[model samples]
Target chain A: MTKTFDIVFALWPRCAQLDFLGAYEVFAHLPGANLRLASEHGGDLTGALGLPLRDVEKLSDIERCDLLFVGGTADMSAATTPGMLQQLRRLGEDARYVTSICTGSLILGQAGLLRGRRSATHWAFLDQLAQYGAIPDPARTVRDGKFWSGGGVTACVDFALELMADIEDPTYAQMIQLYIEYNPAPPFGSGHPSTAPAEVVEALRARFGEKLGKIGGVVPTTALT
Target chain B: MTKTFDIVFALWPRCAQLDFLGAYEVFAHLPGANLRLASEHGGDLTGALGLPLRDVEKLSDIERCDLLFVGGTADMSAATTPGMLQQLRRLGEDARYVTSICTGSLILGQAGLLRGRRSATHWAFLDQLAQYGAIPDPARTVRDGKFWSGGGVTACVDFALELMADIEDPTYAQMIQLYIEYNPAPPFGSGHPSTAPAEVVEALRARFGEKLGKIGGVVPTTALT
Candidate 1:
């Protein structure tokens, strides 16, 4: 019999829509993947932009899995709900591969999985990784032992394809890329602060300065709200 | 009072997850944009990979909308139920701007909106547009009058970004691009048939050969199931 890999995606209220779904798109096509979405509050959960995620399983019940994926939320502060952090920590310890996209690395940091590990997160929150004893890496995706992390929202697609190459084969990853037509052609070419105009970067820094300073908190719902 | 643009996304079972959500990630952030996911089922709908979409509105209730967005499904045969084609035809006529991502353009063709229009669809299905009296342009996105169409799944993100620049302003579109970190770095360059290896393209053509021949029909779920 072929080996079937159980994959769990940790869904939560206000999670960034692209971060989770982008990865799901790539991973779902893997040969033996048994994919499932889980959250602390099962059933329906709302993501950023009022997008609804339906019929999510309880994270606590998903005790064992091959891979566990956690995605970011619009509000970084609300990302680490106390129960959610606990569930993530438990699942992180259990899964063969622990993974995240964007600020999801922050949740891994909060759960102590990133301690002394080189990790990646959204560029806006890269420096904040140090607070949780994580060595911040600015690469698009970073892998340290069993833990894998990727930068920002759309990075999830690249991260998933890379992960597939590691877990399966390079051919499988390339095939899935072709399946989704992953060729991107951005007209403006200003996706990052480094690439964007100076004034646009400054305006964004000022706009996100408050959230950047307070990366994670016990207050919940305070950041990016 | 500020002007509000009522945007409706026409949804159905097994719609390509990335096709709709990628566009949603962009348009949801637009100022005064009232967004909704509407379908015949009107509640929880399953997308590809068994991913659940929550709280969709009924299509019959939405009499008018500024933009009506449609997305493709893996099996285009399963995409258009009789009632769904009716709803699409009604809404496509009412919407100021009618748009689609991937093979969703096929639905618009069925609705008679694509007659003599230069449009785009997934590269694999591009030639099939000739059957519906639509001129198929293999570009990622094409615009003829009020009808807008895009290539495959990930192309929806580029399609939405372009739409935002046209509908609102380039500044707003660029800002959203930054927020989502629209920069893409694919590990392998095999997104299109032209770029992918000859063997891979041949394999895909053989894999999808039958479905391509039959546009939409009662081809039992055996194709991609």
Candidate 2:
């Protein structure tokens, strides 16, 4: 019998709910994969929209895993925390695959795992990858060797299936996709910045520019909270 | 200024995470929308993928809301639970709009909310809507009169934006869509039964047929554990 594939997601404050939960569900449903949530503090972590994740393992306690999954958050402050960066770096160094979804690439980049690697992240923050010596690509998902990153929040679904396909097979990915009914139909047809009206994009920039700008470089850990 | 719109989601065991969470995040971010999760028992409800939802209000405590949302789970078990159905009926009756995601429509159907209405649900179980006198349409998202239903887990995003557009304006919905970067690109093209391979669909039917059959008719509330 094959050994179980261990997958761990680094949980943090204000993480996007879908970024980790979406991919976590896909892997949890897959046969022979051990799934867990890891965080600085082990219990009752909150993500966006007041979503609570229970029974998370302390990050320092987990020695290793087959895959280290990092997800992005609405606030980038956690990514720049010295302790968070160090933990991500340590986990990335040992994991068989270091993967991320949405702005999670920012965390990976800050950890030095994406140094000289091509990556993809939320389109609005793709250029910031350069600050950490990573090449940013605008694709929905990008893979460079063992480093995998996805675009924005919804891109986590794509990243999950693609990673599943790579590790298991397209057949396994297809089956899970069907079971979950992965069909997506955006009613407004404007999910991408390019597809959205210029005024709408400007409005979002005005709304979130300050928070997003903080992601371009790692801020002092003390600056957070 | 318009009165704050009230929205409530019926929470239950095994509820699909994306079903309500996807839509909830969008609405929670929208201004003037009061969002709350209401479950039969309330307090620290666990859903699919072991995702914990915080601060869910007790269903009996919520008298009315502008919109009543219900989400689906892997099995149809929760939909047939008498207590859940009664709460849904009570809430749906008072709400201006009754909405659901994935097989959540099954719960609405069981509560008699979908009686004589056109609805959409998870593709695999669409035909079962007939058991509750509902017209099942395969559209990604369907809005008939005051009832709105989405096709599957991922369809919640579309259902959310559409509902947002209806309550607010298209531009507001577009702005939120851009903020979340809702651009969806499924790595595998098979998100629907029509697009997935026959073998994959067959495998799913074989795996889930037993749990699914119980949903065709209302099971005794006592039957649920």
Candidate 3:
């Protein structure tokens, strides 16, 4: 019985929250959760928000774990790096549970893990999964038994909790919820594209303005509502 | 009036999680959500679990923010840096929301922000809040009137969602909950001192084994329970 668990994630210069911290929380629970942020060389990689990360463990050293997360990437057009996709397939096969969030789902798909499977990704990037023959789940987190796919970045937490329930005890998840206070409150009436005011939606659009027209489908729906 | 926010946090070699990302999600939702991860120095600060963070904004730039999350310290007796308390006091005067999570609530108390106020922290350290004349709440997220105190690290996300509801749209939190697929599934049934196996708890004690006895009250649950 191993007390420690190592959850691995890919490092990109522009990975989103779902790619990193989103799933990081769930992995944080293992007895001595050894989180490994792996890159080609393992040093410093700038995150999407300009936060530079350092002291990453080289990917090769990670041998096995109870969980492995193939974090999504924003760049789909860019060619997959040499051996990266191959490495993901290897990790996915070894870990007890394999999952992905947002565009990372695409990364897993690219690795041939989701072929003929049902999976989820960030709404903006779901189309990429089509080439992999995965049944796209627009929902927050989708689980096809052992294969888990997270919808958006934040969806990782919810999926993580569900994973917690499966791996640990249901009560453990509830206890964490009690400890962390899972109660939610929303200020605006809108969280999805449909509910947001035209201006608020546009405001969000303007923020991601550069990436529009490339993806398929509408915005996300409020989970609780 | 400006949606710009300054998120002040203590950053060093190894900071806690709930302290960093929990509030980030909420603060990032403000209109512009222009976040500044204020640290003692503007460089990499490794967090628990070997996750390293970098490019932190220096503490000097905090002008105003919707919320200021004071993270907990691994070395509290040696932890209270001098000028930071002063800066916190200065920021406390004008910030729209003054919040803390896990041990961060203690930092807020040391900054004189938690006096006569109720706050929250990891259950393992909740009793410590009483040392600074603040009431501790067992709930995942605790609010003393206007002050928002979060229990443990994971609770920070819940607290952030609550705060987000106040400032942004209530639905956005729901959307975030749904988007992230917050449904949790912990592999083990333990994340807290009470529920974790006796050996696990003892192991943790051995790990933080050197926690000085000065905060004896914080360690023993007799007073808080």
Predictions in order: lDDT: 0.81, 0.80, 0.64
Give one digit per residue, the lDDT tens place, for model 2 in B86-141.
88888899899999988888778878888889999888778878878899998999
Interface RMSD of each: 1.2, 1.6, 5.8
TM-score of 2: 0.92
Q: What TM-score does each model's chain B reach against the true chain B?
A: 0.90, 0.89, 0.82
Predictions ranked by TM-score, top down? Answer: 2, 1, 3
- Candidate 3's TM-score on the B chain: 0.82
For model 2, which pairs clash?
A: none
RMSD of each: 3.9, 3.0, 6.5
Residue-level lDDT of model 3, residues B65-120, one tens digit each, is 65666766555542356666666777776787788777777777777777888787
| Candidate closest to the true structure, highest lDDT | 1
Model 3, B69: alpha-carbon shift in Å? 1.8
lDDT of 1 by residue, B1-225 (tens): 168988999888877888998999989877789998998879888886687887889998888899999998766565677678788888888788999988888777876678999998877778867777889999998999999889989999899999998998887677778777888899999988889987766666655456444322232222221
Cα lDDT tens digits for candidate 2, A1-225: 157888989988777777887788688766678887888777877776677666778888888888999988767675557777777888889998999988888778877788899999887778878877999999999999999889888788888899999988888788788767788878776778889988887777776666655433343323221
Residues A24-133 of candidate 3 have per-residue lDDT tens digits of 75567655566777765567776655556777666666776667786665454321454566666777888888888877777777777888888988766676577777
| Separate DockQ for every predicted complex | 0.67, 0.68, 0.25
Among all windows of 10 consecutive residues in model 1 chain A, the one with the lowest summed lDDT is A216-225
Flag the better candidate by lDDT, 1 or 2.
1
What DockQ would candidate 1 receive versus the native complex?
0.67
Scored against the native two-chain complex, candidate 2 gets a DockQ of: 0.68
